[model samples]
Target: RHGMRLDAADQAWHLSTPTPYDPPLTYGGWNQCRALGMRIASLLDAREQESNAGSGHSDNGTKRKKKKHKVVIHTSPFLRCLQTSVAISAGMAQFEAPKDRTSSSRPRTPSQMHSASPKLPLGSQKRYRKTKLRVDAFLGEWLNPQYFDHITPPPPSSMMVATAKAELLQTEEVDTFTPTTTQRTSGGSLWNGANNRAGSSRESPLDDWSHVTNALLHAPIARRDRSNSASSVGSNESSGRKSPFRPKSPFRHGHGFQPLTSTMPKVEASTYYPPQPHYAISNSDTIPRGYISHARVNTVNVDYHWDSSRHLQEWGDGGQFGEEWSSMHRRFRRGLNGVMEWYSQHGSEERGEDALGLEQVMTHESTDDDDQEDLVVIMVTHGAGCNALIGALTNQPVLMDVGMASLTMAVRKE
Candidate 1:
């Protein structure tokens, strides 16, 4: 998934997803999930060895080898989760396959490829069973009853028409810049006006609003960042290493701060409040007098009616955007507690059975009565869900945040 932004009225908010539009994983997201799956498989294999080492001796002093366990994979019903499970399975399969021990310089022939399979690690004749991944809807993102009336079915395909529109907007440029008066009032009115005009019954208007907002506000930021980076940097004359300073201007490339120029439109301080000073410029020792710094700000303007449906919360102090801090904290805490309760009862059991079955299948033997296996649960969900879960588990408030397609892992030892 990639990053996206929503625009309503004159205010815009940014959102990140595993896919550009929704419901699907981007190529990067897919690869990251796949690699994570492989890593999990490797960890399981290592754990299996530890289990074997602990139980290698019988009561009568005879040596016996333990079987490798089976892997049971469960995923959320979301399209991205399903896709991630598939990638992970592929990674596990690749991990299970024996590697060629020949030198990297040597090219393997068909005969070499068809040579007798390598002996099992423990001199056993059993083959590892493939991991079976299952999709479960209950393990999905935390759904607030106040927000959604019922569970929505997954879209037929993750591919979105809006994705095409977004791409088109990325390539298209808007030359006509209409300067509007920036009032001191909280930007909530911008979204309120749009929602009032569009009506609550309509969905198309909201989609259009988000699309147009992305095009008008988001696209420009992306384009400007890309352009500034390309323009500020050039190849070094002697050594090939990237030079820290640029030749044309002393300012760092893509720093988001630009020198005030005659060509740029003048801002009326009476009408517009320039954004808070960025730390980079504010902390600098030698300040340039004529330079004006531009800091990227995401202004979320959600309709009052859809407050329950929206997942965005006021972060940190919450005073920055005039959002109610207590309300957001309560909501987060409730959602997290609910998820933790569900996971403790169901998620733990499913993961244990699946992982044990995988071990048994791979080693072609049942687990010993005394052998306890470590369980690994991989959950794919939204940012809020992830944050809440982590906070609950760590017994701390949510402080760290993850980006789109980011992987977070937790382990439980027996």
Candidate 2:
């Protein structure tokens, strides 16, 4: 207390206090402790008042603090730093010492200010040069992944790709075989995509591919001639060929259709015309071996047959067949294929002088059959209603004697 330099005014103010002052300490410790306690209490308070004579009066305590500036603080910034550090250390000690904050709550002082606080990411200390420098270095690798990581391209979506055009065109052909117009199978040429392959027709690509090799080598004319000669040779050798599968010839009208060998051969009863080089309805068949041919040509197989009564009612004595029927039958005959006719003789007047049959085989034509069989004879004589059987043993007609002399023969050699 004695060490503190108080002015005369301060001494008078202290003497005027209502509280009785204790006697000074043996070593003056009591007065010094009281003075220190009063100083600390004054700093904790928001305002200081001088009782006998107060000189300052300012709002919000700013003027009061200025007037109480009797505190000759060691005011250097270094001293301020030191004071903050000391106060913070003392508070930390109190905190670590388990002082109940709720009971004797006290304000703490802040210390150790850096340039700035750390930003968001881990290890990003604002004071650490490496982290700050790395943050500043980051460019736009965030926005574009392609620039960051390499990527292989993917297949285009359907909407993104345009389709290719059809490679083949369906060109028509003249069925030189049938003397009629024909067409080539383009096999859905409009869409030739690899993904569009379907069942059965998937083989079309394989077949077409085989043709491509030959197509690359041969010119049109050379290919055409080759195809013709190959076809003339046979069908098996020309399987992979690209040339036309058909050829033109008015004299040839049939295709690969052969007479049904598995069934019985019917005897045709019409005005039949044996095939001629000039008026061939169709081409001769390429018959396979072991197949016995049985054909009925120029004769239509119908459920209802023309009876003699109907025939007589139409044109009594004109002709056995009507004119219109004759014309239609002729047209059908002309357009018929593989037409065959068998002959029977009963006085050669055939059924009433007008009944007709197939023309005879040309004498100059060469025949394939080597051996001739026994002639089978059948005749409707002027007699009772009955049919007779002929035996190969004696070349004799059984039951009735209307004999074998009138029958003609056509058969294969053994």
What lDDT tens digits, residue by residue, belong to model 2 across residues 120-230? 444321210000000000000011223213222211111111110000011223222233334344454322334432332222232334354346446453334434654
Please give the distance, in angstroms, between residue 147's alpha carbon in candidate 1 and its true position after superposition: 12
lDDT values of the candidates? 0.40, 0.22
Model 1 misplaced regions, further than 4 Å: 1-21, 58-67, 96-128, 142-376, 403-407
TM-score of 2: 0.14
Q: What shift in Å separates residue 10 of candidate 1 from its native position after superposition?
A: 22
**How many steric clashes between backbone atoms does each model show?**
13, 4
- Summarize candidate 1's per-residue lDDT along 1-414 as a digit string, tens digits: 111112111121113323322344444454555567567668777777666767767899977666455454544445455455555654554465334477646787989879846654333443333444433333344333332232232222112222322221232222222434433323332333433322222222222244444464545322234245443343342346565664433122312223433434443221112232233332212212211111001111111111111122111111112224344445445544544444556532233324455543543444455545433445555555566556756767785666755556666434
